[model samples]
Target chain A: MDYISRYLAWLGDGIRDWLLNADDTGHKFALMLVAIILFVVVMGAVLLAVDRPKRVPRWLVTVGFVGPALLMLTFGLVYPGLRTLWASLFDRRGQNFIGLDNYILAFTQSEFQIVLRNTALWVIVVPIAATLIGLVYAVLVDRTRFERVAKTLVFLPMAISMVGASIIWKFVYDYRAVLRNSEGDLIAQQIGLINQLLVWAGLEPQQFLLNTPFNTFFLIAVMVWIQAGFAMTVLSAAIKAIPDDIVEAATLDGLSGAKMFRYITIPSVRPALVVVVTTIAMGTLKVFDIVRTMTGGNFQTSVVANEFYRQSFVQQNAGLGAALAVILFVLVIPLVIYNIRQLRISEEIR
Target chain B: MTTTPPPVPALVTGGVGDDDAGTQSSRRGLGLDQRAAKAKKRLTSPWASLLAAVIAILWTIPTFGLLITSIRPQSDINRTGWWTFFTNPTVTGANYQEAMFGSQTNLAVYFVNSIVITLPSVVIPITLALLAAYAFAWIEFKGRNVLFVAVFALQVVPIQVTLIPLLTQYVTWGLAGSFWTVWLSHSIFALPLAIFLLHNFMKDIPPSLIEAARVDGAGHVKIFFQVLLPLLVPAIASFAIFQFLWVWNDLLVALTFAGGTRNVAPLTVRVAELSGTRGADWHLLSAGAFISMIVPVVVFLALQRYFVRGLLAGSVKG
Candidate 1:
């Protein structure tokens, strides 16, 4: 056993040294090769194990189904969750038991207050804006001639991931110093499209992403843009599900346009509207990619999720970070429960 | 809550047409007059439909800018508005070429890595969740409802809370910076939702079919493959698309588990890198965005029917 431990230690040290000194391209190629080999070996073992003549027992099959999944969840999810929860009660280095001190700091600290406030703003604003726009769009394009075209165009943003969306919008918020030609006329100053358009309209090009409250709104617009399609698709189906006879009866009673929508359509689609609001709210709680990609959490635009990453990883304050994570979890649980209940009620109605 | 009396008798009686019908028609006529009065009321109000259209157009501007930016040259991108490219029109393939071939940054490698991470990240979760969902739905077991609810409750726990512990575990297990680590992380995060969704779908499958298979010589495994699996195509496809999109577009798990190595970094991380180290290269970033979008768009368009149908099934039914 001692011999084996020494050999393993020696092998690990050798590999670490090689990794440290090796050229980047060579190391990457080597890593890819190893990954492929590992995949082949693991898959081969599984295939071989399952190929036996005697039928794999039901229990074995059950284990096979649940084992890897359980193992993964234990290590990747449950263990980490418990560890973080425990860590949250400790100090920065996770050495001393600080109890609710970190939690108190999280609520009392000014930066954390901003994060909480911004998160609330996101939850309140983005969902309402996105859902309203989506509900309206769904109603408008319900039976329109260009419904498919319009919906596909609108849904196009949903197809782009948050990272991709951020990259796309980063250019929209790009900035550059003004430049002039030899003639001293503003020859061509390029930056963000909004800034460029401002220049074109003979107004001063202002920094869009750096402004505090307005920048928060600008960021929320990105989320609203991406989520509208999701809301539209779900709500459109709910709208479609309203019985035709009820609509006809309402029409016959001379309840037309907005009145019919208010009395009939909105009530019928209330469950779906709840689902949309809660889902978007829950999604807002996990929003880190956009902040990370676009602003790197700069200019006082950071939310709890981004700050969690920054605190834990960048600043190496595990306790405070874990405290933030718990706060986010607390925020999300109610929305998730509400969503689940809404789903259950909808299902029961169906 | 106000408890209104059930209107079943009123509904039934309202169907009869007689002397009351004349009164009802007159009332309806009065309502029509009121609607006309409301129309007059709305003539002076804001055009809500026009406002909606304006909002939709406003929402699309960023995307329009991205499309134009992808086609323009870096010089032009740095020099003028993307809108100006419509008038000047000096498009270049340099950004696309660089993104695909990797001049300074090897984005193509990250794209391939994304495929590696996503395919299994999608397939493994769906496969495992299908079996688990089948068990939860059909197989009589102790603690089934408790287990299902537990899994469902797991969705509420933020992934950030688990990141550090997961990272430490991966390092301890010697799985850090490996493809397996990312795949495993994604599958773990994705499984609760997948199982929840699939269980809902599987519960809707008629029980008689499973009993009929049991009446024959079929075992659970055989029944799962021959009968239940084929019937689960729509559910599987829907879950597959959701999982695929989640994995493909994932940045957090990939960033944490795969580390910063170019070989392991997915397209999301690669695109993120373009902003920091390659900030001035908006042209490359835009083209990279388009390239990364191609797979998801194709996946969505190809399976859009299944996607829509599955959402309806998952949401409306269970």
Candidate 2:
């Protein structure tokens, strides 16, 4: 027993050192190779054990297949999820139990109230705006010669990271304070496209990301930009899926253009439209990157997701962060449930 | 939540079983193809085409601006809008050169780290989920439905709820601030969704196929490896691409576990940090942003058919 324990310790240390202590690119990639080999060996062993000629118990076979995933989920997700929930009940340091205090503060405090408001604003605005744009674009481009290229143009953003997308928009929203010559003539050229457009219209250039409440809208626009592609893809497929007979019937009834779209196209894609809006809402609810990259949640632009990160990692307020995380989790539940329910109904109809 | 409920869009529409969805793509397009011809006869709405053109431009110009700016010289980028690049063409590789190899922002190192982190993260989760998914789909045991449902429900647990505690545990295990931590955490987070999706795919396999293998006295492991895996290649590819893009483009998990260290921090974290600290340096920011985007964009464009299939499966019922 003593030898076994000692050998296990030695093996663990050696593996850890090999995987973690290596710093160079060669060593890191070597580490990846080692991981793959190790995974293959372990899974091979498990399969061999289950494949013995002697009859194996059903439960043992199940365990051999399922144990590893369940073990990982237990340690990594389930146990920690419960712990975070428990920690949210305590104070900032997560020591003293101050039940619901963090939750109360999150709801009542002026700062967090703004966070909630910004989140609500994002959830409502991004999905509707992106979906409307995507749906309209899908209808227009349906079966067109340039449909592929046109769809790709809008859908490209979904391929880029939120961080990258944020950088792009941040450049678009880039502000250089207006400068004047001695004669009071405008001297500074607007670097940002948005402000440049405003200048072209003979309007004062506004700081799109610095203004309160409205700044949140600018951040939300970034999300809508990224997600509109997803909406377009899903809705485009749905539009195409509208039954031929139904469209033929609508066409026979003299329904054309807006009337065809309003009656046939809209009704046919309603299920998909619901799924797209709710999925985008769920995604929008958890969007921290745009806010983090654009404003760093400054100027009252924080959402629940960003605030969770700021509290837990930045401020080291585990309790408050956990509370915020819980709030995010709670917020996502209804959306998921609704999404699944809609999918089931859609599936049944199919 | 209901018992044995389907998982969220990340799974249902995760594009995992998209091969099944791709075959139906032609059928879905049938209605619209016919509608286009009839609609042309009624009234040609030039306004619709114009609106779509405007929307396409709106969607594209931001990225286009960044792309143009990334190549311009530092002075040009700072002094003027990227739109002016056409008239005053002064392109330089210096920004790309510096953003990649320069000190204080050696994105070259982070780019390697993203690759190293993403490969194992995608591979490990898919392998484990394949086995687990096979078990859920084929193996009959007590509590099987319950266990499968539990895994499905786990998808709804926001990753934020698990980060801090998992980090503490990683620290306790002496794995904190390592690629192992990022890889392990990503794999773990990816498991529930992976299992749910693969299981859905496996369940769709004809039961007679499995029964035939069973009648031949082949074991479960053999059947999984020999019979199902071949059929599941498309499914695996779909999820692999999805997870690959996800882990590569991810910022939060990498940021939390790897921090700002060069050894383990991926491109997203480093690029995000650059945006914060060097927000004014469009030369570096634009270059850095593209450095991160190039791989995913290429992958997406190449495999867009499969991606759309997976997406359609998730949203529109297969």
Measured by lDDT, the strongest candidate is 2
- Minimal lDDT window, size 10, model 2 chain A: A235-244
Give lDDT tens digits, candidate 1, residues A149-217. Answer: 566667767767898888777777777766678986676576687777787798776666788877888
Q: Which stretches of candidate 2 lie over 4 Å from their true place?
A: A1-16, B1-36, B39-43, B310-318
For model 1, the chain A TM-score is 0.84
DockQ of 1: 0.25
Q: What is the TM-score of each candidate against the true structure?
A: 0.84, 0.94
Query: All candidates: CA RMSD in angstroms?
Result: 8.6, 3.5
Q: Which ten residues in a row have the lowest lDDT in candidate 1 chain B?
A: B1-10
Native contacts matched by each model:
0.44, 0.70
Q: Is the docking of candidate 1 incorrect, acceptable, medium or high quality?
A: acceptable
Which prediction has the highest DockQ against the true structure?
Answer: 2
DockQ comparisons of all candidates to the true complex? 0.25, 0.54
User: Can you tell me which runs of candidate 1 are displaced by over 4 Å?
Assistant: A1-64, A178-185, A200-202, B1-56, B308-318
Q: How do the residues B122-216 of candidate 2 rate in per-residue lDDT, one tens digit apiece?
A: 99999999999999899888888888888888877889999999999989988899888998999998888888878977988999999999989
- Name the top TM-score candidate: 2
Candidate 2 residue lDDT tens string, A1-350:
99999999999988768878768889989988998898889989998998853588778888999999999999999999999999999988888999999999999999999999999999999999999999998888776666778888888888889999999999999888988899976798889999999988998889999987689989999999998988887777677667668877877898888998898899888988998898888888888889998899999999999999999988999999999999999999898888888878886776
Tens digit per residue, CA lDDT, model 1, B276-295? 77777888888888888889
